[model samples]
Target: MAGLWRKAPSPCIGICKRPGGICVGCGMTKADKKTFKRRRSKGERKALFRILIERLDGMGRLARWEHVYRRRCDRKDRPCPLDKL
Candidate 1:
């Protein structure tokens, strides 16, 4: 059963440059990524996503990130966690 459990998809979107304190792609810091990796529960990940979504929207990059994040989910055939938010 453990092998059948699939972890949630990351919100990185492959753009990993953090010029400031935040990721230009996912609106998360390096610390955020590390925290995300450590969080195993869907509730924790989804809660983080909500915080990042608001930040991204404030930065005017939410649309692009959402587009890429959705595509990433599609490629993996996994449900977009954002959808549940």
Candidate 2:
């Protein structure tokens, strides 16, 4: 079902921290967030999510990111992908 979509939803939680170029809310960097706007295949988006999850874990912020992400999904009336991850 994920592959059926033409564009991937962003993972931002709206809390951007410019000092480190990493979002303290969703754990995505500026570049990482920009990648979602590119013309990437669904599979590529899913792969990117995996890498993002790992990055969050490496920073010991996966739990925080997940919480924020879920809320963001709720606000956007979209399904949360954390279950898929």
Candidate 3:
């Protein structure tokens, strides 16, 4: 069961553009970004990333986010959840 647990990677690509309170870079709101760092629950982080991806997709910025996020995951040595989706 422990093997099933995976660390969730932060979705921040570091652009940090908050247009209408939603980040144009990672699709995370200010609160979401803050909550991400403090979130100990892997499930919560994954869920947040999932929602953010959907939001980015809607905003037509999914490709850019996915590209950078994949690189971030690689640098951190984590499997990108986006690839699995």
The clash tally of candidate 2 reads 0
Candidate achieving the largest TM-score: 1
Top of the candidates by lDDT:
1
Please provide TM-scores, in order, for all candidate models, with all chains considered together: 0.86, 0.75, 0.81
Residue-level lDDT of model 1, residues 1-85, one tens digit each, is: 2211235578898888787789889999988988777776666776788999998999899999999988988899877676667
Candidate 2, residue 42: Cα displacement in angstroms equals 1.9
Q: Cα RMSD to native, each candidate?
A: 3.1, 2.3, 2.4
How well does candidate 2 match the true structure in TM-score terms?
Answer: 0.75
- Candidate 1 accuracy as TM-score: 0.86
Q: Write the per-residue lDDT of candidate 2 for residues 7-61, one digit (tens) a residue.
A: 3358776667755766666667777777676736767777777877887798788
Quote the lDDT for 17 in model 1: 77
